[model samples]
Target chain A: MEQPMTPEASLRLIDEMLQQAKRSFSRMSFYFLLWGALLLVATLTEYAMNRAGLPNGWLGWPILGTLGGIISAVHGSREGRKAGASTFTDRVFMWVWMAFTFTLVIIIISCVQVGQRPGPWVSILTAMPTLISGGILRFRPLILGGVLFWVFGLLALFQWPEHGALLFALALLLGYIVPGFLLKRQEDGLRTA
Target chain B: MAFAPLDPVLHNQLRLAVISLLVAVEEGDFNFLLEKTGATRGNLSVQLTKLKEAGYIAVTKSFKDNYPNTLCRITPQGLSAFEQYVKAIKSYLDK
Candidate 1:
């Protein structure tokens, strides 16, 4: 007959479960890197186009949007297939980002309809997911990144229209690229050690 | 001088490990539980059956990549039982 589970053993198991959950969710930095790089290119291109008096330079937005959508769909489906277990936190994270994506799409559509640049709206709204995600994960870097998003977001909003693209690009660099790389390093360390 | 009885169903080490994991994450799959517990396939399977019989867990069998997959989730009864088990263990230790 098996021995009864001791209190010490139960505590150990709980610790293991927590560790597993953390390991599973902590490997999401690649998404940050991917989206950040795309947005950086798009924003810089928009800025250049406006400066050069190029017609349809803003077409970068639609191109980037289509490419991003395809990449996300493929990456997400692949991740879903590999995922063996999911926690409540994972579900909450998915919904939070989903809402953010939905809101962003609506804003973009409205901007297109009104013949307005979506730069300011994009910059400000980008903070919501990062802020909430950081809060949910209790990760300080992500929290700080989200705050930086808001700071740059405000600059994008209040600054001259010509500078809006530049501010948005800066936001992506500080908010997404930096945190994404940090997370990637952390995950790598965890996997190695 | 009295101590609460440890639940017979949850008293075993592997079984307790399984429930503890399920309690933490709303659900997990067979391979995930196996990897976490570091238990042999046969032993884990038996423990899972015992938990299912006691109404502490629900198991769903589905196919993935042309392979049979088993997913397990803790039932409400299992959650209550786990809570009670923790309380009972604490009482024993406090004495």
Candidate 2:
């Protein structure tokens, strides 16, 4: 025979159950944003690098820039996971597709740049497919970043081709840096509440 | 993995305490479970091994930073078993 459980004990049990549900939902949403944003950035960086003719040697600059974005994403995600709050599945398919798109975009952008074209118009023109696809996917962060890239791309063509690289880097700041901090805050809120 | 219902260990109070704690926490180290359940080391280890061998939980051994770690997570089967135990206990209380 067992004694009756106290009210406090029962309430604690309920609290624990609620916490598990919150964690599961937050985790799934976090992964969707993290992977989706990363895939877009990787594709765009590679395209920009080839358009700028920054590649000097055997390895193309676009390839290096895409690789750099991947490393940044992996490091950022691992830190979040160690915080034991916001880990999620790595979207392998999404990443592979990103790499393939980068390869194709670099080829096209390089062709345009090699033709002695100077301006953001070429970059903006190339961005249409990504912009439409990102918006249709309902991935707000990626769509937002793609739009910023498109704006900077137009700037390069119309206003200053020389400033394109700097403006593009600023766009990355708005995209990953801001959202990553927001996600960290969101996780902390969930844990505390 | 499907765990056999009515396993004798599932009926024991101390073992049930450990399982219930694990079910809620996701994963816990041995000392954490011992602290939570108030079970002695030998008894907790025996019950954990039984649960692991029964495929109702997975025990991962590693070093966190530097110190040793023994992390245990309840399997899907364990969650069902825990839920069943809750239902059974409620029925018994109702009687």
Candidate 3:
């Protein structure tokens, strides 16, 4: 039989578990980057088309939404199947993002119905989850990203509606893509060490 | 002074490790525990059984990718025990 654990050893075991749980969130950046790239592409395409005086420039959004939904579903299932453990922290983060996604969907639908640009609203909505997630994970870059999202979101709201797409695009790149890459790098470092 | 007595079920190194891990996470599969603990398959299996028998944890056997998979989760009883154990150990350290 294995020897009984000393109190010190037991404490160490608990510490290790906490560390592992924190590390489990490393892959979160991948999802952020994925959505960031998708939104960047869609918004930039719309902006270009509009500048070219093309009608139905907004059609790209529906196509992108469909693609995004399919990709998110597949990614979610794949991650779920491969995941080893589900921590309470993990569940909380999942629900936070899920709520964010739902709110974004509602805003998008409302914007379309009312014939208003969804850009500023989307950026503002994105800030809530980003800020909360950063706080949860204690990741500084994500917090900064959240703050920038708010800054750009407000700018998009007050600025020319014609520039809303560009502003939203900037917010995404700052709020998701850049921090996402940093997070990925940190994850890789942890793996190598 | 001697340290506080530890709960026999959670006193063993591997079992303690397993319970400690389960306390942090909602659930962990056999492979996940194996990976985290770096314990042999047989050793992990035995400790899991002990925990399950003590009503400190629950194990579920399921199939994934046409292969058998086992998942383990801590029970409320287990959580309470762990908390008490920690408190006891803390008292000993304070002394």
Candidate 4:
């Protein structure tokens, strides 16, 4: 049975819901924006280093997939449990991180086919995506992972070109592995709590 | 000035569990409430109606993915009720 609500009561309810939604959504917006910009910077830097003849650019593909994988888990384990949906900005950061990482990897693979070494130009191109991912996550784990990967990636560039692959592997593990493990642990604790 | 604690009106564990979960998310889907609170469909439906009648929450029925969705968002009144519940429960510890 439908009981008709007076127009006044209906208006009051709407007003209350709107006000509550505004306050809650606004609080979440600040965090999303802060994380979004950081993701942007990372993606750009990673891409730049790869395009400049870097031999290790192929490694950025799995790295990008890894970032996306982390985002998928994050949405499931953490954000799903949250009070509200992840904002538009947060989704943007996730996609951008994926795009940059994938692009760098594809570029590097193309270069490898030509039997090229990733030069200073290539390394510069590759820096963009790592920087983007680190900035976007805004959590300590990802930030540290990005910085470590970028720094070590750069350092490996200075050594023999052949070692770029090894360096990329190490950086990938550092950038993605540690952070994923940490977040998993945190998610488990939250679930149990 | 501190006010005297009131006795718990809705002592049913299911209702209390629903309230506890809502305090965390501020809003939760009916399915989530049922899952987390471990309440049966009929029990959850009854208790949710009671909470709504008491002005603790506003439940909205909608469709998501062509499936019926029941979303429960806590009202300001509900938040206050949960807060007072905490204070009242804590009075026992205070003694």
- lDDT winner between 1 and 4, please give it: 1
The lDDT for every candidate, in the order shown, is 0.82, 0.55, 0.84, 0.55
lDDT of 4 at A186: 53
Off by over 4 Å in 4: A1-143, A153-166, A182-193, B1-3, B7-12
**Model 1's DockQ?**
0.58
**What TM-score, to 2 decimals, does candidate 2 have?**
0.45
- What RMSD value applies to candidate 4? 11.9
Interface RMSD of each: 2.5, 6.8, 2.0, 14.6
Q: Could you give the TM-score of chain B for each candidate, in order?
A: 0.98, 0.82, 0.94, 0.87
Poorest 10 consecutive residues of model 3 chain A by lDDT? A17-26
lDDT of 1 at A26: 30
Candidate 2 residue-wise lDDT, A109-143, digit = tens: 77666874422443454355444434544446646
Worst 10 residues of 2 chain B by lDDT: B1-10
Docking class of 3: medium
How do all models score by TM-score? 0.91, 0.45, 0.90, 0.51
Candidate No. with top TM-score: 1
**Against the true two-chain complex, what DockQ does each candidate achieve?**
0.58, 0.09, 0.60, 0.04
Give model 3's DockQ, 2 decimals: 0.60
Kindly list the per-residue Cα lDDT of model 1 for residues B1-88, writing each as its tens digit: 7888888998887888888888878778899888878899999999999999999999999998899999999999999999998888
* Rank ordering of all candidates by TM-score, starting from the highest: 1, 3, 4, 2
Which candidate leads in DockQ?
3
